[model samples]
Target: LGMRPPTPAHPTPQYKGRARDFLYAGAEAGVMVLNAGADVMRFAPSLVVEEADIHEGMQRFAQAVGKVVA
Candidate 1:
């Protein structure tokens, strides 16, 4: 199946001060160190997903984070 972009992309409003700098710095570090693809932090909604699928996605996300940090 062909890949499709997520609908209704969430917008992260701009921040200011040290927090803004930190966010950018963290993103830069993540990109440099992890070389993660675009979907690394994706949040996909279930079109008709059951509770089990939601749970599985959560578990998978947790596992991915663990692997990245480990």
Candidate 2:
């Protein structure tokens, strides 16, 4: 499990939002995997985010999974 600071230095608003979404998505996927008896979550920092970037990451992660599964 990797924990990153919420905000990145000198990030544009759009990129920051994307990062938050990705982070949220990744976390949700990780939880689902864990519940399904998976061993690990290979989480990494997005290299940027805003102070309000928590739940957005999970949403982004869920979107990614939808695409791949579709």
Candidate 3:
């Protein structure tokens, strides 16, 4: 999340391997993200997911991204 936003013209291309880093870190943090491709990290929390759960997921994801960058 600390990384710059993807460019509108080439979003996924900018974070190709970082997506995998996120997936692994998310898994380690007990978050499941479905991968659409080599560069896509997809999040589809359940329709009944609570707000707190969403916030927690984001925290996990941000931590993962930080580790990856660090």
TM-score of each: 0.39, 0.31, 0.72
Q: After superposition, which runs of candidate 3 have C-alpha atoms over 4 Å from their true positions?
A: 1-14
- On residues 1-45, what C-alpha lDDT tens digit does candidate 3 reach at each position? 233332221125556656777788779888787666667777777
lDDT of 1 by residue, 1-70 (tens): 2443443212233321223233233344342112123222334444565658656655654454444345
Clashing pairs in 1: none
Off by over 4 Å in 2: 1-39, 42-51
For TM-score, the strongest prediction is: 3
**Which stretch of 10 consecutive residues in model 3 shows the poorest summed lDDT?**
1-10
Clash list (residue pairs), candidate 2: 20-57, 21-56, 23-57, 24-57, 24-58, 25-57, 25-58, 25-61
Residue 60 Cα positional deviation in candidate 2, in Å, after optimal superposition: 0.4
Q: Alpha-carbon error at 65 in model 2, in Å?
A: 0.6
Task: Return the candidate ranking by lDDT, descending.
Answer: 3, 2, 1
**Which residue window of length 10 is worst by lDDT in model 1?**
31-40
